[model samples]
Target: MFSSGDLEQAKTNFPEASSRDLKGKLLLPGFIDPHSHFGMMISAIGQANVAPPPAGTVTNFSDIIVALENYRDAFGIKLSEWIFAWGYDETQLAEGKHITKIELDKAFPNNPVYLQHVSGHMGVANSVALAQGGIDENTRDPIGGRIICFDDGKTPTGLVQEISMYYFAGKAIEEFQGKKAELFPKAQEHYLSFGVTRAQDGMTDLLSMAFFRSLAAEEKLDFDLVTLHGYASLKNDDLEFKTYKNGLKVQGIKLIGDGSRQGKTAYFTQPYLTSVFGCEKDCVGFPHGPQDELNRLIGLAYEKGIQIFVHGNGDAAIDMVIRAHEEESKRLGQPLDADRRPVVVHSQFVREDQLNKYRDYGMLPSFFTNHAFFWGDVHRENLEDERAFFLEPHS
Candidate 1:
C-alpha cells in the first residue's frame, strides 16, 4: 500500500519476510505487538479449537468430549493416533476443574489425546497419551515442571506442566512438520491477512528451533520469526544469537520464572486466597527453577551479551528476575541502566517497587493489558484487591 520510497523505508525498519513475493500487493502496514507464538500458532491452525466463547463453544467436560469426538470423526483419526485439541481452560468451564485422565480415559479409551491448556504452560493428557509420553505415577517431575497428581500425591492426574509437557508438545510439532507443505502457506496467510508481517515465537525449544531453521534453509518460512530460546535450550552453544537467517532469527533467551497467575502457579509475595493442587498449604505458587539456577542462567546470558525476556507474572517471580539482573550487572561491571534493553514479558501483578527496579535496570516491562478484560474476575478472586487493581501496570 505504499510508493517505492515508503516500501524501501519499510524494508529498512522491518525484516523483508513480508512477502518473498507479495504477489502484487499494496504497501506495508503499521507494526503491532500482539505477542503471538508464531510457529505453534501456525501448526495449531488445523488443530481442533476448544477455546472458550468467540472462539469455540466448549463450556464443560461434556462439551470437550463432544468437540474432540466431532474432530475425531471428522478426521477419521486412526486407532491410537494422537488426537490434539487446543484452548481448554479450567477457569472457563462450568465445573471449574481440570480435565484429567479419568474423563479422557472414558471418552477415548483407545486414542491418545492431548488437550492443550489455554495457557501454554500446561496440558491434560489421556492415559494412552501419558503412557506414550512415558509419564506415570513413578515419573518424577522435571526440574522446571510439575506432574499434577490426584489427592493421593502418587497417582498422576495426567496434567503436566512446564518442561514436563515438552514431550507431548514436541510430538505434536513433529506431526505438524509432516503437513508443512500444506499448512505453511495457509498459516502464513492467516497472519498476513491481519497485516501481521512480524511475530514472536516465544520460548522455542531446541527441537522446534531446529525445525524452523530447516524451513528457513528450504525457503519455506514466509514471515519474520523473532524467536526466544527457552532457558533450558540455552546450553546449545551453536545457536547464532543476535543474527538472522532468512526470516528466522534467534533474538534472545527466555526464562520462564513462573507460570500464569490465573492457573495459581505464579510466584507471588503473598499466599493465594485459595489452595491449589499439589500444594499442602499457603499456596503462593513456585518458580520453574531454583534461585541458583536463575542466577546462573541470567549470568550466562549476560556474559554473552544476549538480551533476556523473563516471564514473571507474580511479584516474587519479578523479584527473582530483578535480583538476577543485579547480580549479573555487578559481575560484568556494568550499571543497571546500561543499554542492554532486557525485557520482562507479562509483568502481570508487578509491584510498584519492581517498577522502580525496572526503570533503574533499563528493562522493558511488556504488559499484556488484555488480561484485565479476560481474567480480571479470576484475579480478583485469587489476589488481594490491591494486587488485582495493579494488574498490567501500564502508565
Candidate 2:
C-alpha cells in the first residue's frame, strides 16, 4: 500500500498524473441502493409525474389534474391512447383526499386515465380504465384487495388496492413495452445522475427477467443489475437460478407479506391510533396470505438453495416471516445458511423484542429509513406518540 508521501512524489515525477484535488473535502465510496426497482422506474420514464414536493411538487388535486393535462398536451397523445401517471400521495394532498373516477373522467373525457399512488400499493382508475379492465360496480373485490366505493357502497370510487393495483399496473406496463427501447436509456440516465453505479430490480417477473437479459446481451446497460424474480411468477415455470451474464444476475426470489404503512394496509399487531380513509381506527391491517403458506414458500426456497427477500413493513408481518424462518431452520436441523442471507425488506415497524429474533435467525433487515424523513409527521398523527417515536429506531 502506497502512503500519501509516495503518491505526492509520484504526482510530481509523472507531472501528467490526472487526479482530483480533495484537500479539504471528505471522500466516500459510491452509494449502493439495495431495494430499488430499476426496471419499474425505467418503465415510468414517459408516464405523467404527479408526485408531491421533493419529487415534482404536485401538492393538490388541481395540481395533479394540471400535470396530467400538460403531459397529455406536451406528448400530443391520441384520444384512444391511455394516460398513465405515477406518484400521487393522498396523505400529502391539501384536501387529504384521493382523486376519484368522476374527477379523472372530467379531466380526460375521451382518454382512459390511471393515476398510481405514491405507495405503489394502490391506484385510481377512471371509468374508461375500469371498463378496459372489465371492472365495474357489480364486480367483487379480488382477494387481498378492495375497490373503494361511495357512501351507498354500490358505486366504485375509482381507488383500487393490493392485487387490483397489480392488475392495472400490468396493463400499463404492457402498453409501455412498445416504448421500452427508447425509455430504457432515459431511466439509466436518471439513475446515473444520482451517482448510482449498481441497481437492483427488486421484484421482477419472468418476462421482465428475459427483457433484462436481452438488454445485457445487446450491451445496452452501463451499470450492474441484480434482479429478484417474484415467487408467484416462478410457480408454474421450470426456471433455475442463473448466475452473472454481462453485468446482470438473478439474485433471489421476492415475497410480499403485507402492504404499505402510509396506505393503512401494513399488517400490525395493534390498531392504528386514527382512522384512515377506508380503514377504521380499530382496524389492524391484514396479511397478503396465511402464515402457513408463507412458511411453505420459505421452506421450498430454502430447500432449493435460493435466497428469499421478504417484504415486511409492519411488526406483525415481520413476526410471521421470522416464524417461518425459525420453522424452516428447525426442520432442517441446522441454522440458516449465512451466505444465502434471507432479507426482510422495509422492516420499518420492527419492535424491540424482534431485534433479538432477527439476530437469532440470521436475518438481515433493510430498513426504509427515508420514511422517517418524508412521512414521519404523518406517522405520528396516525400511530400516536409512543409508536411514532419508535419508528425506524437507531437501536
Candidate 3:
C-alpha cells in the first residue's frame, strides 16, 4: 500500500517502470505475447459489423441474399453506395460458385455490393467497385495474385484474391489512416487491460512504423513493443532493417506464402470440394513464393541474421518453407537456436513429417486458432483426408 507521494518518488527514480501507480493485482512472471497484428486488429475493430448467414443457411446462396437484404434494411443504408458485408462463406453457398456480381446486382439493383470472404484475403465486389478500381476486362492480374473474371465478353465478375484486392481495400485503408491512428491508443488500452506487458507489432511497415515511433518518442507507448516490419516484402529496401536494435528487435522476416481456408485459395495438393466441372487443375490457390525466389530470399535473410517467419496455410506452401529452412540449415552446417525460436505464423496445414522438422530445426509455430472455431467444419469438408486434421494438435 504505497501512498501517492511514495509512488511519485518511485516513478521519478525508476523512469522505465511501466506503471506509474500500482492499482491492480501484480502477478509474477506475467503475460508475454508471442505474436499479434495490432494494426490489423485496430482496422478490424473499425469495420462495419454485418451478421453472418445462419449456420444451416450458409450452404445456400439465396439465404445469403436474404441475409444481406435484412442487414442492409436493418441499417437503413442508402441505395447510391454499395452494400458492404463481411463473413460470407462461399464454400457453403449454393453450387459453391459464390454469389456472382450479376446475382448481387439483381438483388440490390440500385446499389452496388461487395461481400468479403471470412478469411479477409478475397472478396467479390459489384460492378461499381470494379469500375472504381479501374479493373476492366484487360486488367492483368498482378504477379503472385489473381483476378477472377468471366468468360465470353471477359468481364471482371468482381472476384479478386490476395493483393489484387488491394486495388480497392488498400485505398480505403489509406483514406482511413488518420482515423485508424486515433484508434491505436484504444487498442493499446485493451492490450494493457488483458495484462499483455509486451507485444510485437506484427505485419506493419513504413507509415505505421513512423506513427508508432512518434508515439514512443513522446513516451506514450502503452506496452513494451517489438515491431516487425517484414510482411510481404522479401527485400530490405522496404523493411529498413538497419533501424532496429535491442529496445525494439526486428530479428524476424514474415513471408506470406499462401492464402487462407476461408478464402478458398490455400494452395492444397488435392482439389477443393467446390472445384467441380473439370476445374480441378485450376482450383488451387496462388503461391507468393516460387521455388527459386524463395530459396534466394531465405539465404539472404539467413546471411543477414534476420530470422524467417513464413506464413503457410496449406501443405504445399508449408513444404516450401520447410524445404527452404532445410537448405539454409544444411548450408550453414548447424541448426538454429532454441531460445531465438524463429516462428511460422498461422501454420495451419503442416503435415506430420513437418512437425518433426520443426522440432529438429528449433522453430516455433504461432497458430491462428481463431479459425479453428469459425471455419472448422468447412476445413473438415474440404481437407478431410489432407494434412489439416492435425492443425493445432496436442503433442
Candidate 1 lDDT at 374 equals: 72
Per-residue CA lDDT of candidate 1, range 1-395, in tens? 44345766777767654647667876556455436577788678768888888678999999999999999999898898889999988888999889899999998999999998877888999999999999988999888788999988889998998888989888888877767556667877877787777778886766667778888898876677788887765666878877888888888888889997888888898999876878788888889888888889988888778888988888999899999989878988888888888888888888888898888779888757777777899999988889999898754
Clash count, one per candidate? 3, 0, 1
Model 2 over residues 287-368: C-alpha lDDT tens digits? Answer: 8788888998988888777889998888899999999988887887657534568888888888978877777667888757
Residue pairs whose backbone atoms clash in candidate 2: none
Clashing residue pairs in candidate 1 (N, C-alpha, C atoms within 3 angstroms): 1-26, 1-27, 2-27
Best-performing candidate as measured by lDDT: 1
Error of 2 at 316 (Å): 1.1
Worst 10 residues of 2 by lDDT: 233-242
Report lDDT per candidate.
0.83, 0.82, 0.67
* Model 3 residue 230 lDDT score: 61
Error of 2 at 50 (Å): 0.5
lDDT of 3 by residue, 211-281 (tens): 76777677777677776656455554545453533334454676777887656667667667655321346
For lDDT, candidate 1 versus 3, the one ahead is: 1
